[model samples]
Target: MALSGELWADLSAERRIFCSVLLFSWTVYLWEAFLAHRQRRVYRTTTHVPQELGQIMDSETFEKSRLYQLDKSTFSFWSGLYSEVEGTMILLCGGIPFLWKLSGQISGHAGFGQEYEIVQSLVFLLLATLFSALTGLPWSLYNTFVIEEKHGFNQQTLGFFFKDAIKKFVVTQCILLPVTSLLLYIIKIGGDYFFIYAWLFTLVVSLVLVTIYADYIAPLFDKFIPLPEGELKQQIETMAKSIDFPLTKVYVVEGSKRSSHSNAYFYGFFKNKRIVLFDTLLEDYSSLNKEQTEGEDGENEETKSKTKNKKQGCKNEEVLAVLGHELGHWKLGHTVKNIIISQVLSFCLTVLSRRFEFQADAFAKELGKAKDLYSALIKLNKDNLGFPVSDWIFSMWHYSHPPLLERLQALKDAKQE
Candidate 1:
């Protein structure tokens, strides 16, 4: 028997919807890639004063460069807006058809009605997620490889990136699939009351996951070792003791193996708490004080000059200042406040993220001198491409971090006391 004309038309419509969504996503991705390429070109071609200038010049030049890049990369704005519109359209397009098909199949059966609906909903959700991931993976790869590499910021090898992706995918499925199945099962059997119980269960599970993330999950991907014995470590321990922070273990992470960025953080609760510094910071500090020859034999006068020119590359005082700032986040209750604020803001617009970032900045100031923090911030700012400070609202909604200028200003204001 031949298929009916109406059925053929419906199939065509579905196909067209899928094609349209894919086409729009790809177009937006391509435009973003092109803009990123242009921004990199502009950054590389632009000339600026040398970094050895006085602190004010260094900060100003860094801010200007960042603003320039921000203006050139308006692609983020366009892509972000398009992403929301495209995502909603694709969901509606795929979901409505799935619902109709499921409804029709269930109506034809007697005892299978409730079971079919539950099964179909689960299947539909899985299919939708899979489709989105598959469609989006190419753009993620492009960003990591083409865009990041062009700017010399990409530290991940293709193998590492893929391995990370696989691990994340497995973890997500392991956690999500069982919970989804259970929820659907409850909905099938418990009818209306299942939703209340499901909500409570989900909230409890989310809290547990958040608690375990820093302690249990983070170490699975990155190795953390106790910060080795050194003057800096002793100083940190002394500071912790002064604050009655119960000094136990200090650790350094192997972040430099992946990227040149330097950072420190405090993790865990109570006695389980520990501080971690990046090994890159350690290496940078060691090299700065020495003749610049370490594990690599290619190190020469040129290497030493380049290393010296790198803004605030691994200075112990700067590291201490940065770590102090992070400690401030904990000491001033910014960390706990941030957690509560995040939960409250999860359903709202992204303004809370920016505000919390400023609060952390203020907290950092309470722990360290504003000048030291400002200097570290200036160095970090100069080392990377700057985005526009005026695009706070756009960036707050799209990006995870606050502008460096905003952070600097917050520190400056806090220093007023």
Candidate 2:
């Protein structure tokens, strides 16, 4: 009877509810992937580029970008399906809860009494994490080696990849083990106010992590080379001052070491905020700016003059305009707003999250950067997540930023107020 009871308890109706939720979530994910594909299809079918966004890319590069988007969406759909299925199978087979129970057993063997809820919680979290990582390792490998390489973006050697994987695992465990344990411990000790205090704890941790990430954590992955004194730096500063945006020096991260993807972003709070541009972004900028071969063997005065005089295809004004858009996020307090919404109203994330993209674009335009920003976007078009996709349904759930067309239209219609 005891054995039967144990089996019966294991197969309780609650498990069914949990499995159902898992399946539903996966189905939603697959549907989102389908919508991404649909968006790509629509983009392919549409020939006419709107005047506002026409300069984003030339016809040829735009076609290549569309194909790339299609490829990515196709891969994501299949991989997403496999992942969902794997998760569902694990749930249906009682793997996660079994793992949880085993974690408790192991913790007990270590003399962490079962009564110690914190130890049990921490053990379960770690074991569960390890299990998931092991299961997902193959897919991660395939993604980096096959899919990304096929797209000409995989730059890490096998040695670097393994080292990175190890570092990430160690760093994540170090951080999450303590944070998650504390949250769970709070639940045990706080009683009725557990959730309220947990919420507050999350907010503080989020803010702290944001402030320190560029300093403490990011150095593990890439080098942050300081941008030297030049027109680019000077213009960026000028633009910041013109808008009363407190300025700091900019950095150029060695982004091309891992992927050809490009980006620029801001970090720090208030006066300490820093702008970071990607090496790939500067690759475009190099066409307009003189290249300095300071440490090169073939350097001569004539070569230096030629490198300096070489016409970098991008303009300084346009680059500053891009910086202006990034600055808009800080000015509008979008980052803080996002943190609050995510911690408090996570359910409303889909709706409330994407507006800030538009707001920042508008802010950039308001800073008298409209035309130059347009020019910059044109140069950086293929480097972004843009494609011609008619993806209304796909966008409903997954889009955390406005579509390129929408962004371009917003910029066109924006005015200083």
Candidate 3:
């Protein structure tokens, strides 16, 4: 008892806080790992497709999806473990304070005194982000080149990939450094209610980012071409008009330059709203229709090894259906509501209840998009090779939206009604 009391007395508050944080982080990781293990077990053991999935997923596709998900789960496990260990080691070894001291030294060499605390903080932030990016690069490369390439999803050459990565890093620093400097300056200068000023500054910055992201920032990374004069464009315009949506223009982004995955989204505020569609989402424009990579003059490895996968993208009506669902979010104010909710609440995971999703689906149904949306959902699920089977706990905890099967059934039910 005497030795125990001595040991307790010897533990500093800072040490206790650090140990507590580390313990909390590991606990969260272990919980997530347990949930993931359950889901991976489903992926591994469910060799045959469930009866409900039979209508949408063929045996080959089912097996492929299962294998793909299993591989991803395994990769996630190892990567997550590595991250936890890295964080632990950093904390244990005083990596943060060491980096801060190093940043101070660097800033001092640059002729910035301790009085220039903001400059020192900026240096520290840059060094921390640089370190994080460097450490995570190998994992990113493996996921992109190994896992995605093996799955016939990766679309970039090594040169293209590296160039893209460098561009991303540069752009991130450009945005992060300025915003962070301004934010710190605000916090430092605001006399009593610094927290309020900081919050307002962040809110304004977020809104500005959202407004400019698609038009300016995104186009820096991906090519955005106008969705040309055609039936699809006509229908999209008509649909927007019907909902009184003040849509300015539609642009198709060249997403296939990086991956075979397909998506669509809208951005901007009030009267200046624009929708951006992935080129991979339009049937006529999908590059997945062509042979996947360069220099496959003859029957190459992918051609020889695998059967031609199902063609990606949706038909004109299906595309409209998908857009209807997205526009539903706008019309129902779900997007704005989500932003407000996220601003107020700090969730460890971004999992929200599926009420908003179901509401959006129902809104689409009200727009007479039920049949088309149902088929579109199936096509998308197949195109992305999303594993249908999920452990309930994992799905409930992790998924922001309801499952594909659930959405399909809801659409079907709506159609019947």
Candidate 4:
């Protein structure tokens, strides 16, 4: 008999293990949050900036950074705790099975039988997604309107928020309905080797999404205006040429419409590849605005290159420094490698990704502008109000990006090479 159907005494053993795993995960996250909170407190009280990062920000900016982290961590901790509790409820309350049963009933009422793969799968996914969305709405609202707004990062108005939400719903349904239906059909057709076929199908879909995401999907949210003829654009193209990184049209997105953080990134593959910069980043870094402490975070946050602005004049060299780091990924083939790793079923593959990050940094350093790249990194860390994770275990096992300190050290080490 299935564990769920077993006698209470027998089921208790398995339930204990599941509960323990859940509890352990929650505890680790809470502990990490605590460490981050403590780290921020230290930053707030101390005037000492790490020798490497001091060039990027002053004591005042450092305090500002610490304050941002405090707000972020506080929100992260409480929201995480709520998520854990909600997840526990969902599991123990038999909510998933109930949702499944409800989906079947709804589909059947529509003249689709329970055994119809496409209908059954589509209905379940649709309803389940709706349920997830409704449950998550309150937290999303608080994050956007309350926490983000408090941190000066929220650019969304209520009208824009609702519009984004509706668009997301429509887009998700458009993608999910057909995708889930096809996957269900494949499952019905493929028996023993279903997993192999499913993996291949997923790989194809992932590749397609990546190709279109920056070009097509992103434009759905924000406008992309071509970077005008300027020193910055010339430098960007020149750097891409030097690295032999595929360059298409360089377009700057109006990312400030959503958030006050700035970024540069390269997206797509082959002929489709393009370099994109957030307009806020260009404005912040181009003229080297000593007064502007923030930039638009941009739509694609997947790139690394943290910086905090210091009182300096605009140097096209600084923007080029950021571009060098982005091109490093394209030149080194880490982007496609990352896509492959993400799609595979592996436990340790993710940890191995830290190597790819370092390698890309090395590539950036090799392209010259090592000092500018270093400066950009410092600004990014300050701008993002980021700190190094003190917990070594969590840093190694969980962090997707290398900690800021680690990257700074990496840049320092790269210069030696």
Instruction: Return the top candidate by TM-score.
Output: 3
- For candidate 3, the clash count comes to 0
Worst 10-residue stretch by lDDT in candidate 3?
298-307
Please give, for residues 63-173, the per-residue lDDT of candidate 1 as tens digits.
565554644354454556557666667576776687557554654453556546655565556566666677667767866676655554456677777777777776777
Candidate 2 residues lying further than 4 Å off, grouped into runs, are 1-16, 43-56, 284-315, 344-350, 413-417
lDDT agreement with native, every candidate? 0.61, 0.72, 0.86, 0.70
RMSD of each: 8.9, 6.4, 3.6, 6.1
Q: Candidate 1: deviation at residue 30, Å?
A: 19
The estimated TM-scores of all candidates read 0.67, 0.83, 0.93, 0.82
Tens digits of lDDT, candidate 3, 324-345: 9999989989888887888764
Please give the RMSD of candidate 4 to the true structure.
6.1
Model 3 misplacement above 4 A: 1-10, 291-309, 346-353
Best-fitting candidate, scored by lDDT: 3
Cα error, candidate 3, residue 219 (Å): 0.9
Minimum summed lDDT over a 10-residue window in model 1 is located at 299-308
lDDT of 4 by residue, 1-417 (tens): 566456545657778787777779778777767766665556455556667665556777676666666666677777777877888888888887898888888889999886675786678888878888888888889888887776556666777787888899988898878877777777778999998888788788778887888878889988887888877778777777776766879988866667667787877767767888876576443322323234465422322122324432224676787787777777777787777777664445557677867777777788776777777777666555566434565466556667877887877755533
Error of 4 at 260 (Å): 0.7
